[model samples]
Target: MSTLQVRVARKVSEADGISSFELVAADGAQLPAFEAGAHIDVHLRDGLLRQYSLCNPPQERHRYLIAVLRDPSSRGGSTAMHDEIEAGHLITISAPKNHFPLEPAARSLLFAGGIGVTPILAMAEALAGAGADFEMHYSARTPERAAFLQRIAAAPYAACVHVHYDSGDAAQKLDCAAVLGAPRADTHIYVCGPGGYIDHVLGAAKALGWPAAQVHREYFSAAPVDEAGDTAFDVKLASSGQVFTIPPGRTVVEVLAEHGIDIPVSCEQGVCGTCLTRVTGGVPDHRDVYLTDEERAANDQFTPCCSRSKSAVLSLDL
Candidate 1:
C-alpha cells in the first residue's frame, strides 16, 4: 500500500454538476506516474476513500487531474470531491493504480456511461498517441451534463464517438449488440459506468460469444455492507496466532481492525481488491466483484469487508 500524503488540490474547471480537481504533492514532489485508465484513492475531508480515474494525459506529470460528478445519492466521496475540495486545499490521496488496463490489441472500443468517462478518456488519449484504431461511445443523461465534451469531440476518431442523450424519446440507449458487432479480429472492448451499464455491456458481449479475454470492465459502485448478528464466530489470525470473535453484526474487517490488525482497504464495499487477504480455511461467501471464478475456487483470497465466512471457524493468513 502506498502512503497517503496531503496534496494541494486546485480547481481547474466546473460544469454540468461536475468538477475537475488537480492534485499535486504539497512539497513539490513528483506525483507517481500512471497510465491512462489508472485511478487513485482520494481520502476526502469527510473520511471517505473514493476512487477517481486519471483523465489527464500521463505526459503531464506535474499533477493528476480527476473529474468528479456530484452524485445525488452519493455515499459521500463524489460529493466531497466536487463540492468540498477547493483550489489550494490539501487532500490525502493514494498513488495511482490501474486494474482497467489497456490490453494489447490491434483495435479497441471504449464505452463510457455518464461520469464513467474518466478512465475511458485516458484510454482514448493513449490510443490516439499509439495510432491504434479505436472508437469512444459516451452516453450521458444529456449533452450539458457531459464533461470533457470538447476534448473528446476533437479526438482523431471523433466521428466514431457516439453521444447519446436520455432527455426524451430520443434517449440513446447503448446499442450493445451494435457496439459488439464492430469487433475485429484481435479487437478488445472496455466498458465502464454504473452497475447496470457495466452489467448490460458485459452480458451482451458474452451473449455475442465474445471471449472473456476480449472483454474488460471496471465497477464504480460498491456492494452494500450487511450488519453483524448476535451469533459470533471465531477468526484465527495465522500471522499472529490470535483469535477474535466476529460479532454477528460486524464484518471480518471490522473485527480485525478492532484487534489492531490493518488489512489494506480502500473501498470497504468490496469493489476494490485492496482489502483482500488469504483465506487459509473457510467457505467464504465471496461477494466481491474484483475476483474471478478461478480465484474464488482457490479459496486463497477473500475480501474481509463484504465477504463472510460460512465455516464456524475461519482462519486467515492476514
Candidate 2:
C-alpha cells in the first residue's frame, strides 16, 4: 500500500489512558474520503505500524481523527504514540481501509466496548445525519474509562445513545438479553471491541436465535496463542525452491521476513487477511478468526502471520 505523509494537528485527552490524535495533510490538501468504520495504518518510528479507527465524521475530509490507548504490554506502538509522538510531528500512514463498515439496513444496532467506541461514534453520526433508525450502546470498565463520551453525548443522536459501565449501578448496566435477546428482521448489529466483549455479544445473539449473517464484529486482538502446543515446521517457497525452518516460537511471517521476503501485513494478530497466502500442500493450523468455517475446511489458503503448519512441512505458492 502507498503511504501518505501527514502532520499531527492536535491531541486531546479523551479519557483515562486514552487520547485522540487529529491528523491532517501536511501539504494542506484534501484527504481521500472515507466512510464510517474505516481505519488507517499509522507508521511509527522504528518500523512500527499500527491500525487505528477513524473517529471523525466521514463528511469531514480535512482531518482524520484516531484514538489510541496506552497499553502497558504494548510492543511499542501504543506506548510510543502516547510518549514520543507530539503535535506538528509528521508521520507516514496508509490510506483509510474498512473491514467493519456500516451496512445498509432498515434498523441498525451498534455495540461498543471501551475503546471500540471510536468507529461506532462515526457510524452514529452518519446514521443520525441520514435520519436512519439506529441506536448505540457503549460499555466500559468505568465511566471515566470510556473515550469520547462527551462528544457522543453531544451528538445529534444523543437520545439514542446508552451508556453502561461495569462499576455503575446494576440497574443501568447493559442487558444483552433485552437488547439482543430477539432478532429483528432486516436489522444488522455491528460490534467492535475486545475479544471477550465481542464474544459475549455474539454469543448472546446466537443463543437468542439471531442469524449469524446479521451479526457483525471486529476484534482488536486475536485470541491468546499458546506456544506450548507449537512445533517446528518447514515452509518451502514455490518460486525460489528455498525452504525456511519455522521454529516453534517463531511465526511464518517473522521467519520469511528475516530472509528478506517482505510480505505485506497489517494486523499481526491474524485478524486481518492481508498476509493470507495460497497453500499448495500440507494442512494449516488455522488459528485465525478472519476465515470462515467453509474457508478453513477448504484448506486452500492460510494467514502466515499467526497460523502454523499442522503437518511437518507446508508448501506456499509464493
Candidate 3:
C-alpha cells in the first residue's frame, strides 16, 4: 500500500480522553484531497496499524485532522499515539480511504456517540457546505467527555446540531424513537458509535419500518462473541488445491500466513474490510461488523481475519 510521510504539526486534548492530531505533509506540499467519512491508517510502533477518521472539513488539503481516544484496552495502537507520538514527530500513514461516504438524500439525520462524532462531524461540514438539509444529534456520557463541542457550536450550522448528555436531564436525552419518527423514503439516517449505541439507533429504525438501505451505520468496535463452543475447521484454496486446518482459538489469517500465503489485513477485529476474501463454497460464520446483513447473507465473501467457517470444510477463491 502507498503511504505518505507526514509531520505531526500539533496535538491537542479535545476532551477527557480524546486527543486530536493535526498532520501536515512533511515537505509542506498539498496533501491528497479526501471526501467526508474518509479515514487514514496510522502505522504505529511494533507494526501496529489503526484507522482514524478525518474530522476536519473535506475541502481542506493543507492538513488532515484525526482524533484518537486513549483506549484503556488498546492493543498498543491508541496507547502509543497518546504516549509516544508528539508534535514535530514524523509518522507514516496511508492515504484517506472512505468506506462510509455520505449518500445523497433530500434530508439527512446523523447520530453520533462518544468519539464516533469524528466522521459525523465531517459529514455535517460537507452537508452544510452544499446547503443540504440535515440534522445531527451528538450523545456523550457527559459534556466534558464530548469531543469538538466548541467546534460544533461555532459551526455555521450550529443550530441544526443537538447535544445530548447521559448525565443530563432525562427529557434532554436522545430519544431515538422520537427523533427517528416515521421513516421517509427521501430521508436517510447515518449513525456511528459503540456497538450497543449503534444497535439502539438501528433497532429503533428497524422497528419504525425504515428500509435497511436508508439506514447506514459504522461500528467503532464489534461486540465480543462467545467462542467457547468454537470448533476446528478446514479451508481449501481453489487455486492450488491446498487445504489448511484452522484450529480452535486460531484465526484463518494466522494459519494461512504460516503456509506463505499473505492476506492484507488491518483492524484484525474485522472492523476494516481489508482482508475480505471471496468464498467459493461452504457457509461462513460471518463475525465481521463490516459487511451488511445482505452482504453476509450472500456468503460469497468473508473477512478471514476474525471470521471463521460454519461448515467443516470451506473453500476460498485464493
Candidate 4:
C-alpha cells in the first residue's frame, strides 16, 4: 500500500455537525489516483486509525476531500479529525482502497444512511457522468442532522433522489419496499449505512425475492467482537515465520500491531475490512458481517480483527 503524508489544507463544517476536511500531500505532490466509492485509512494523534471515504470527484486534482461526523461516543477518531486536525498539519494515510466498488449494471439504486453519504455521493456523480439510470435514497435522523442534504438535493438526478427523516413522520422513514420494488434483472441495489439500516434494507430486499447478487452493502459498524464470547487462538504469520497467541481479551489486530507487523488496519473493530489478509491455512470463524458466504467459503481472505481461527493455529498470507 502507498503511504502518503497528507497535510490538512482546509476545513469546513456543514449542517448536521458534519466536518469536511480537504487534505493535500505534505510535500505538495500530486495525490494518489482514486475512484468513486474509495476510502483511505487515516492515522490519528491518539494512534487510532480510522477509514474515511473520498467523497470528492476524481476531477478535483488539488486535494482529497473527506467528511467526518463527530460521533460523540467515538474513541476519538472523528472527534480528533474534526477538532485537532487543522490546516498545515501533517498526517499519515494509506492509499485509497475500494472494496465497495460500483458494479456494471443497466440501472442502480443507491441508499445512504447519515454519514454513509460520503461514498454514495461519488457514486451518484459517476452514474450521472455515464448517463445511467440511478436514484439515491438518503435517510437521516432529521433534516437538521443530514449532512450535505442541500448539495445532494441539487444533483443531476435530484428529482429522483428520495430523502427520509425518521423523526418527521412514519411516511418519511425510508420505504425500502417502495424504492426497491420490482427491481429489473440488471438493476443493482447498493447500500451503505449504519449496521441496523444496512440490515433492514438488505433483509427487506431479500424477502422481496431480490437475488443476493443484485444487492451490495457497506457496513459502518463492526460486527460483534466477542465471537463465542471468549476464546483465545494462535495466529502464524507466513512471511515473518513467527507465531502469536491471541489472548481471550485481545483481538488479532491488537496482537499483530503490538508485534510491529504493520498490517494495514482501520476500524479495528473488524467491519471496515481494512486489516483483511489472505489466509494461508485454517478455517476462519468468519465473525465479520462484511464478507459474504461465498467469500468466507473461499478462505482466501479474512479480517484479523474480530475473526479468529477455528483451527488451533491459523496461518496468514501476510
Candidate 5:
C-alpha cells in the first residue's frame, strides 16, 4: 500500500474502446490530494491491481485523469491497459482513495454507465466547482461508446450534461423512470455502472422513494460470484489467535494470505472498501457494494476481499 510513481501524462482516445490516462507527478511532484469520488491503485504487471476512477477535475493538481475500458472480457487488468500502457510509461499507483465520496446533498444526480464515466466525470467536476446543484445522467452503448462525449460536450457544466443512448431514440434512452422517477428532497443520487447499470439505477432509486441514504454507488465489478453457493468459513484471527481455513473457492483475503496475512487489498472486487474487516463474530455474507443497508444490518464489518461466512465462525478484528 505505498506506490505512486505516476508519469503517463496524456494518452487520450476516449471513446469506442475508451482509453484516457494522464497521470503526471513522476518528478514534478505536487500530487497526493484528491476528492470527487477518488480511486487509484494501478500497480499492474503480474499482481494486476487495477481500480481506475478519478476522471480529472478535483481542481486538477497537474494531472490524474483516468478512463480505460478496453476490457473485452478482461481478467488481466483491461488487458494490461490495452496492451502495455505507453505515453511516458512510469505507472505504479495507489494513493487517491475514496470509497465513492462526494456526499452532502441538497442537489446532485449523476449516474453513468458504460465506463461508468469515471466517477461520474469526477462528480461533474466537483459539482461544477462547488457551485453545487447537479445533473449528469450519461448512459452509453452507442454515441460511439460515450467516454467523455466531447469532454462532456464541452464542459463548463455544459448545461448539466445529459447524453443517454443505446443507439438512442426511445425518448433518448435512459429513463430510470424519467430520471429516477421522483425522489428529490433535495437530490443526491450518484451511481457508477455495469452490474446491470447499478441495478437499474439503484432499482429506480428504490422504486422512486430514494432514501437509503439518498442512493450512492460505485461498483465497477463484483456481483457475479456464486461458486455454487460458496460456504466453507472459519476465520478468527483477533491479532494472532489465527485460525484461517476459508475454502469454498478461497477468499477471506485468500485465507488471510495463506497464514502470513497480508490484508492490504484494493478492490479485490468488493468495490474498494479495500478489504473492510473488523467483524466481531459471524453473520457476514454481504457481497459488498461497500456496505449499507444499515451497514449490512450492523454485522460490525466484513469484506475480507469479497465477504463470506454466515457463521461457521467469522470473528476478525485483526
Candidate 6:
C-alpha cells in the first residue's frame, strides 16, 4: 500500500488519558482528502501498525486529526504514541480508508462511547455541514474522561449533541429505547465504541424491530474469544497446493510466514480486515468483528490474522 510521510504538527492532551495529534504533510503540501468515518493506518517503530479514526472535518485537506486513548492493555501502539511520539516528529501513514461510511438518511442517529467519538465526531461535522437532521449522543465514564467536550459545544450544531456520563445523575443518563424509539426506514443508526456499549445500543435497536440494514457499527476492539475448545486444522494454498496444519494455539498468519508466505496484516485482533483472504473451500470459524452477519454466513472470505477454520481441511486462494 502507498503511504504518505507526515509531520506531527501538534499534540495536545484532549482528556485525562486521551491525546489528539494533528498531522500535516511533511513537505507542507496539501494532504489527501478524506470522508467522515475514515481511518488512517499509522506505521510505528518495530512494525507496529495502528488504525485511528479521523476526527477533523472532511473538507479540510491541510491536516488529519486523530485521537489516541492510552490503553492500559495496549499491544504497544497506544503506549508508544503516548510515550515516544512527539510534536514535529516525522511518521509514515497510509491514506484514509473507510469501512464505516455514512449513508443518506432522512434522519441520522449517532452513538459514541469513549474514544469511539473520533469517527462519530467527523460524521457530526459532515451532517451539520449538509444541514441534515441528526442527533448525537456521547457517553463517557465521567466528565473528565470525555474528549472534545469544548469542541463539540462550540460547534454550530451543538444543540443536537447530547452528553451522558456514568457518574452523572440517572435523569441525565441515556435511555437507548427512548432515543431509538420506533425504527423508520428513512432513519439510520451508527455506533462505534467498546464491545459491550455497542451491544447495548444495537440490542435496543434490535428489540425495537430495526432492520439490520438500518444499523451500522464499527468495533475498536473485539471481545475476548474462548479458545479452550479450539482444535487443530489444516489449510491448503491454492497456488502451491501446499497443505499445512495449524495448531490449536497458533494462528494461520504466523505459521504461513515461517514457510516464506507473507500476507499483509494490521490490527492482528481482526478489526482492520487487512489480512482478509478469499476462501475457496471449507467453512471458517469466523472469529472476527470486521464482517457482518451476512458476510460471515457467506463464508467466501476470512481474516487469517485471528480467525480459524471449522472444517477439517480448508482451501485458501492465496
- Root-mean-square deviation of every model: 2.6, 1.6, 0.6, 2.5, 15.9, 0.8
Clashing pairs in 3: none
What is the lDDT, from 0 to 100, of the residue 24 in candidate 3?
100
How much is 239 displaced in model 6, in angstroms? 2.6
Off by over 4 Å in 2: none
TM-score to true structure, per model: 0.90, 0.95, 0.99, 0.89, 0.35, 0.98
**TM accuracy, model 3:** 0.99
lDDT computed for candidate 4: 0.84
Off by over 4 Å in 5: 1-10, 13-43, 53-84, 87-108, 111-134, 137-150, 154-157, 162-188, 191-210, 219-289, 293-295, 298-301, 306-318
As for candidate 4, its clashing pairs are none
Ranking by lDDT: 6, 3, 2, 4, 5, 1
Residue-pair clash count for candidate 3: 0
Please write out the lDDT profile of model 4 over residues 119-223, one tens digit for every residue.
Answer: 998888888878899999999998888887777777667886888999988888888998899757989999997888998998899888999898998887764
lDDT of 6 by residue, 1-318 (tens): 999999999999999999999999999999999999999999999999999999999999999999999999999999999999999899999999999999989899999999999999999999999999999999999999999999999999999999999898997788999999998989999999999999999999999999999999999998899999999999999999999999999999999999999999989988989899999999999999999899999999999999999999889998
Candidate 2 lDDT over 124-164, as tens digits, reads 98888899999899999998899987787787789999999
lDDT of each: 0.81, 0.89, 0.95, 0.84, 0.83, 0.96
Instruction: Please report the candidate that would top lDDT against the real structure.
Output: 6
Candidate no. 5 TM-score = 0.35
Best by TM-score: 3
lDDT, candidate 3, 47-105, per-residue tens: 99999999999999999999999998888999999999999999999999999999989
Better of 5 and 6 by lDDT: 6
Q: Higher TM-score: candidate 2 or 5?
A: 2
Ranking under TM-score, best-scoring first?
3, 6, 2, 1, 4, 5
Q: Give candidate 6 misplaced runs (Cα > 4 Å).
A: none
